[model samples]
Target: MNYILSIMPSLFAGAKMTLILFFWTLITAIPLGIIVSLGLLSYFKPLRLVLKFYIWIMRGTPLLLQLIFIFYGLPIVGIIFQRYDAALFAFILNYTAYFAEIFRGGFQSIPIGQYESARVLRLNYWQTLTHIIIPQVSKIVIPSIGNEVINLVKDTSLVYVIGLGELLRAGNVATARDVTLIPLVIVGIIYLLMTGIASFLLKKIERNFAKWK
Candidate 1:
């Protein structure tokens, strides 16, 4: 018990860093994804091409490689970010591409008749999107979005590569110092709890959306 208590501070601090990365990335990614998805669907041919290429690049690359490139390689050309910032940037950029794809799929799933109906009702694009399209898309993509959110929780551990002392790193330190697997076990439990909480909240939101539908 005393050993566990003594280790709490380091673990908590690491968890805090992990949670911060997860929150900011999620907050930024989803909204930016919406814009990118709209670009994918745009009638402006050049814009669509550009967005498609951008999405392809982000989706094609491994996120760990992107993190390394952003943190290490970019400094060669004088683009530098702090370790945390680099991780956050990489996460947001990568997840935004994925979420954009998800949103694009949701947008495509909407029936063409709905758009024509909106036109018949004299609804402008913005009005149609805000009033009708968004609500349905929100519900349609909830499961996919929930999966990403849970993945983000686990992905936070990847920040350890950049020497940021996130949860898993903290556990590694304790395990190495104490020469016991208890710390690693605790770390796994923490991770499970984090994902479990995320799952619960996402399911509740999904149920609420189902009610709306």
Candidate 2:
């Protein structure tokens, strides 16, 4: 329809922003999550406690509130970042906490016997973790990680509150001008398509990893 055609560009622009936010959040959050999970699993009492507390705080607060605080409040503390960057930072931190918890659960699911067997084989802690633990944990964590990736895709719309000019923001701008509601519909379709593609890829990854188990 002509209505759909008119708003296609704005919708696509929003889609681009959405993809940027989702991809970067996953790219940064996954490794950070692994580090935090490792910290919580450490033998050091203080380190474990600190990492646990960090995860609890991030998981406990609302993501939107966290975003606002990072963008609006951090400037008072001389830690200013641009709106998009601030949103990215907040999303990464928030998602890291969540992914860390998922990774921790995956790690815990591995049996104690495996660690003992690794020790008997003369494998050091690092080698045992890299070879024995990580492989198994990757399987358990893959499904959870996949779910979080999908969530991150949807959460991209939330960045609009920070003036990120993402898909939802573009729709809002279109709405204000009394244009056809086609823009909003197109935004939804874009998200649905993006999520579908992501879901397909993650499912493939899961299957590939599942084979090792």
Q: What are the C-alpha RMSDs, in order, of all predicted structures? A: 1.1, 1.4
For model 2, residues 1-213, the per-residue Cα lDDT tens digits are 886677778877888888888888999999899888988888899999888888888989889899989998899999999988998999999999999999999889999999999999999999998898988998888888988888899888888888888888988888778666767777788888999999999899888886665
List clashing residue pairs in candidate 2: none
What TM-score do all the candidates reach, one by one?
A: 0.97, 0.94
Which 10 successive residues of model 1 have the least lDDT summed?
204-213
Q: Give candidate 2 misplaced runs (Cα > 4 Å).
A: none
Compose the digit string of candidate 1's lDDT tens values, residues 139-169: 9999999999999999999889889989999
Per-candidate local distance difference test: 0.94, 0.88
Error of 2 at 12 (Å): 1.6
Q: Which candidate wins on TM-score?
A: 1
lDDT of 2: 0.88
